[model samples]
Target: MIFKNRLVMFLKRQCCFCGAGFLFAAIAFTGVATAQAGSSQPDVRISLDQAEQMALAHNRTLRADLMLISESKANEITAGLRPNPVFDTDAQFIPFFSPSNLNSDYMDNSAQFDAGLSYKFELYGKRKARIQSARAATVVTSSIISNDERQLRYQVATQFINVLYAESKLRFAEQDLATFDKSLSISQKQYQAGSISHGNLLKLQLQRLLFQTDVTSAQVAVVQAKDNLRQLVGFDSVPQNYDVIGKLEAPQPKLGLMDMEADALKSRPDLQAARQLILQSQSQLHLAKADAHPDLGTTVDYTHLAGNNDLSAFATIGIPIFNRNQGNIAKASAQITQAQEQERAAEQLVLTQVRSAYARQQSALQVVDLYESGYLKEAQQSLSISQYAYLRGDTSLLNFLDAERSYRTVELNYRQALATAMLSEQRLEESIGMSVPSGKVH
Candidate 1:
């Protein structure tokens, strides 16, 4: 109680000076807040933004997606390479049985020895076509991985909100328990003084059990929420005793559905990936057409036969009478159409998401406004009045208890509204494929 009084004193005045004063105020407030929160320091404290950054940096799933990009680049190297030359040396018609008659002239006449080197020269720019297709495919893969990052960002944000909500509920439960303890002490005094009946005191004592239950339930919720967040942020990044530092309060947002859709079209990685797929398909078609033309095989050889030495060259090519890659070329062409349709679908989905998220955000904001405008203060004031009246023998026990329950319900609902509002903002940003304007932090 004395600490809260001192905290209010520190929070009350404006800065004594400029820049330095602002820094001093910030540091002082942080220290006071830390001191007020707990006797021992937490292992770590993170805000929503920090949690998102940690998740992006340490997430194993994202690292695996990045590895796919490296794999695709390696494949590009393979696609750009040309075929290796074949070398051969052979001795034919050797007379192994006639050892006595194996003179130099007989060997030359009877044996035909040859050494040859051959290479297949690709036609229709096949190697170049392969390289283009591979590079385009890599571009597509990169965009897809970027889209994965977008999804991860959304996931991290939602989980961070969950942690914040749980913490809020836990704080409320503990604070409410403390308030009830004071009330119970007063009830005991009243019972001893003959100002309240024993039965009425017992009823108030039994209600303390409800407050204790709330605290226990809230503690479990905090543990479960943190555990779920740890899985997304990476277990190694933070200790088990880590805590999130934030409050439950809604910030007003200004967003338009049409503007959000425009941003999505420009910024959405999935949409970009879909468009890249069309280019990737076109490159594949080019590679397929290149495959229809047969490569030219050329060979040069040196032969020694009948005491004469000769050098000969040969060239060969398939007649293309049976196969011309007709099926693969047709398939590649059809894939281009498929990719185009996919891009169209992606664009439509992005717009639909923007609208849905916008509507949700609006609904959440309304609830937040409903709480903030009157219900929160009204509930607190009503509970305070009832408590004062009951202790002075001016109100019934039933009225005091009713007021306390109403206050608790209002506060819980308000916290939930705050969480819903924040989550809606996250969803909206995800639909737009970029971070929106920052809101006032409470």
Candidate 2:
């Protein structure tokens, strides 16, 4: 009975061990499967607006420029302040003896402490002009930053379009390859049955190879486009690639050409920046001209001589005798002329940029329309006919391959047109200093 009892307990323990091992194995298997599934899934998708926001936050270049604007603001603040006062103190010993003719055996020691406060009120309006100029310079720096942001947003939009284009091409290529594989299978059977020539079979096989090459090329393009988008948004790992569902549509811009010019003249950062420089120059000229006037100052002094102290007050005026500021006045006048010329140049340049940008935008719109209405439809028709001819045994494999190629080429061209058109519109708005409503800082 004892031996039987021991045998029963041993069997129970073995069974328990087996159950434990199975449970552990099941848990491990489940974990591995879950991990694989998670890895295979694509990343989260972001819309165009979301992408723009991300770029604004992460783009290193824009952040660097923002820092520069801060620095310029500091400089503007400094320009408004008056110069600090100067303090002087001096002590001299005359070798314990005065000069032979002056002191005549008297020992001399003297100490002087002079503290003076001086301020110029800028009676000629130079300081006010300087303050205005500094403020204008700040505006200019800010405008430059806005222009940069607009351009960056446009770039991100273009890259996003490129990624979508490459993905679309890859899908089409893969679909065509599958179709060619089936066609090649049919040709092989026909050749074996003596219903089709060996030449036709060879052609189909060659076309299959070509289609496979196309698929490979398209996949390479997709990788490259993804890398570019990643770099643009400062993403470390690849984002989940999603289909771009948006179509390019021209929105009726609320402003006319003349309106754009007016807006740009008022708000365009580059032009405003130039205007600020002109103002700064004007202020400098005022300063130079002000230098021609005499500087008036008052002085009060307390002196001790040979144990006697005396207090005196004096009003002084510097005539600028030898340097009567003639050269500076001429230079200041020249500077004013130079600044006026720059202002004119800036106005002309803004007009030219606006006109050119408008023309390009119009051309882009027309090009996109042409591709959509004409080439895209023709390419689709050609692909349909080629597909039908293959099934009917009327089209050679080479001819069908050419038609497929034409179709994909035209489709890619259409995508390119859409991307370019959007970029052109953005550029036109930027050129005209019209800010897009990007849901960020205006």
Point to the candidate with the largest TM-score. 1
lDDT of each: 0.86, 0.67
For candidate 1, what is the TM-score? 0.88
Model 2 earns a TM-score of: 0.72
Pairs of colliding residues, candidate 2: none
Candidate 2 on 204-258: residue-level lDDT in tens? 6545555666666676676687677767666732354433445545433334676
Clashes of 1: 0
lDDT of 1 by residue, 192-249 (tens): 9999876577668657767766766676777789888888889988987788888777
Off by over 4 Å in 1: 1-39, 438-442
Pairs clashing in candidate 1?
none
